[model samples]
Target: MSRSTPNTAPDGSSLPVVHVAAGVLIDMQEKVLLARRSADSHQGGLWEFPGGKLEPGEQNRDALCRELEEELGIQVRRARPLIRVTHRYPDRAVILHTWLVTSWEGDPRGREGQPLSWMPVAELPHWPMPAADIPILRALDLPDTYLITPPGFKETALFLRQLQQALDKGISLLQFRLFGLPASGHEVLARQACRLCEEYGARMLLNGPLKLARAVGAHGVHLDRRSLMALNDRNGYEGLLLGASCHDALELEQAQAVGVDFAVLSPVLPTLSHPDAEILGWEGFSQLSQGISIPVYALGGMAPDLLEQSWKQGGQGIAGIRGLWPSSV
Candidate 1:
């Protein structure tokens, strides 16, 4: 197994990080279990997924099963990786390995005498939680596949027709990346695409300027690495969903620092378009993403069928251009 490198502190010192295995136990009603940390513990009083530190030589799944049994008094019968978050606090860093416990024996109780509750998924954001849990919520809200538009289609009518077909087939999250088009043309197509997406109750993100995204009434903007690096802060994007394209760990860190809602980490495999680009195999991707506290989509050479693989490797989902766009169209 690959291990993540320690994070550097502000003064250029390495920070010791504890790896924790946590579980999101969802009941039949779809409400998720949350536990409040003890007042004297680190990040005390914050609501968190019930879990504990991984014991030496313990596998993540075994650790989760052990923690759930000990902390919640439930034996995990079935579970899977949901998300992994790495958060840096002033004193120490933590790598939170979160699992979705689908089935368990016995009912959950606060075996450790901690405060516990099962909150509706919709209400999760309103509750105060540890900083690391934010991305877990976001991951839960997103779909398994994110579609990006290719620049091949030159006509707006043709593009919209294809997009409608895709939406009809249940592609809910889309990125309108009309690169190299004239400003006027791009805006016109974007507005139409946004309207089309709204009609389907889907979300459309413009892969261009923030102003263009807003002007066209897009749900958000998808920034390239250049734009991500150029941004000074996340103030103006408060009302919108922000996503960034990242190629490496440094760029992923930058994206997280700027408060983007999610990120697309690319070249997880060799791609037809960028065939020569360096690939981050599943191991490398997992290692690089270990401490990231944001939903990351595996972007290069991905298809809907790869969603399961992506999840196992700690990705929220898979994102692609060619793979999602039907060749028959």
Candidate 2:
């Protein structure tokens, strides 16, 4: 067993990366399996998803299967890629290829003499985990489709109706970007929308000032590019989900540095509203996202059909205003 340190690059530049396969072992009751590392082990004393490092020349899935059996006494029968995370610590770096264990044989018990527990997903954030596992937790909390409200839905009744329809259809994550409304009007509609969101068990974010978000009881705020650049730290916004709109690598870096929970990287494809703006294309988007641990949503000219494509290109999911919302409720 070894103590885990912050993954600092060797020679103060680049660290050797070890590829590892990990799993989120879920049981029939919907509780996820968690194991505590031995006190002398790397990332010691923290609870982590059960799985282990990939063996040399082994495929990721096969490695996960082998690791789970050796460490947890379970046989994985069904699993799928959940998220890939690349993290660096002071002493080492790792690429965590995580999967969602949908089906497995045998009850899970720590075969390595470590403590094991089953936890609900909602309780994950309360436990102490490694830095590398933070993004995985955030990914679990988010949905595959992120919706943004169109700019000028002035009628509160109509907006609420449309929002309800979307929510009914299972749009769990949304950002209310009503920029055209007056301050007073925005506040009123925001409160109404928050109430509506609660009814559907959806999370709502306000795309405006932090004060306004707090006043209206939003789950978080989506900072525009300008607001994102103006922030130096994420001190005041602790405990709330913070997100931002990013256009390039620099903006994405800034978002990560400020401790944003997630980000929307836009113009992946040409948009009807901004046809002339430069697009990131899938290749460019993938290039920029390498080694970035934060979850990203692909925006601009996106629809539900492109959800898989978004994930294939290193995004958590897709975000769109027109593509996600119906023209009329």
Candidate 3:
């Protein structure tokens, strides 16, 4: 077994330790190599990406070359580091260092006694994988700018009246993320919200509850980072849009790889809610969005006025809590 070690996060926390390594076994078609874990190991009998621990003082490229050979028996000539994923399990955590490896030498063989599967990019969700891997899967499948709900003032009777007034004023897409409501009340509210959205020819994403989304006949699902990480078969929930919230380059890359229609990149600006958290300025946003084929919306402290600026800076659109929720058109 590969020796485990403590891995520090960017924030200097040790709560979620990861074994940093890279997996670079992809082709032109964007299909990637997947390996099932042997039933003997931790999270055994489950599917996992192939890679291992990075040695000290080793750069990503060198580590990938070493780990691929050690784990998969394949020699890599060139590999491109694409994404990084940190997964927290019950006992331990692992940081999956992913790379878009287009070229390699020799056919990959599972020398580790685990079964191998060649998965197309679009079909990646079929296999059971670690929870953290889900965002990557959705990102691989989706595009940008999915509708967030309650486009105008939220649906208090008065708020609902105001929202109705704003619909014709041009709030086209929305997601109903109403929390704290009883299930029965939620059903009624969701139906009402859905009707309003539909009347406007807008789309709606149900937050936190796929079953509720299905029950409410929503146009899609807005997966929080947790939900995105936990989902294995996004394709199984047919006809519903799959969207995710992303906070970093790694999450964005995974979202794109998994084919999520669009993703929200949040905390572009610091907020009162999370004052301690660092905000990724436009420059950081640019770095993350560059070369990504999917559309990225600037989330956190963004407003409708910021849309034009965001687009000029390569963002698809803007997403916000207070900025996009008011009754004003």
The reply for model 3, stretches above 4 Å from the true place, is: 1-155, 327-329
How far in Å is the alpha carbon of 87 misplaced in model 2?
Answer: 2.6
Winning candidate number (lDDT):
1
Error of 3 at 221 (Å): 0.5
| TM-score of candidate 1 versus the correct structure, residues matched by position | 0.88
Global lDDT of each model?
0.86, 0.85, 0.68
How close to the true structure is residue 289 of candidate 3, measured as C-alpha lDDT?
A: 64
lDDT of 2 by residue, 1-329 (tens): 11223345422456766777889987778788889999998899999988887766678888898999999888999876667787778777877888888898988888889899999999998999998999999888888899999888757788888999899899989999887777888899999999899888898998998998999999999999999999999977866789999999889989988989899998989999998999989888777765477889989889889887877667888999999887776
| Stretches > 4 Å off in candidate 2 | 1-14
Candidates 1 and 3: which is better by TM-score?
1
User: In candidate 3, what are the lDDT values of residues 169-243, reduced to their tens digit?
Assistant: 576656677767778988887787778879887767788587889888788888888777666656766888877
Q: How far is candidate 2 from the true structure (C-alpha RMSD, Å)?
A: 3.8
TM-score against native, each model: 0.88, 0.89, 0.53
lDDT of candidate 1 over 1-329, digit per residue (tens): 22334466323558777788889988889999999999999889999999998877778888898888999899899887888877777777777888888899998999989989999998999998988788889877778789999876857677888899899999999999877887898889899999999999999988988888889999999999999999877988878989999989889889888889899998899899998899998888776665477889898889878888888988888999989985555
Model 3 scores a TM of 0.53
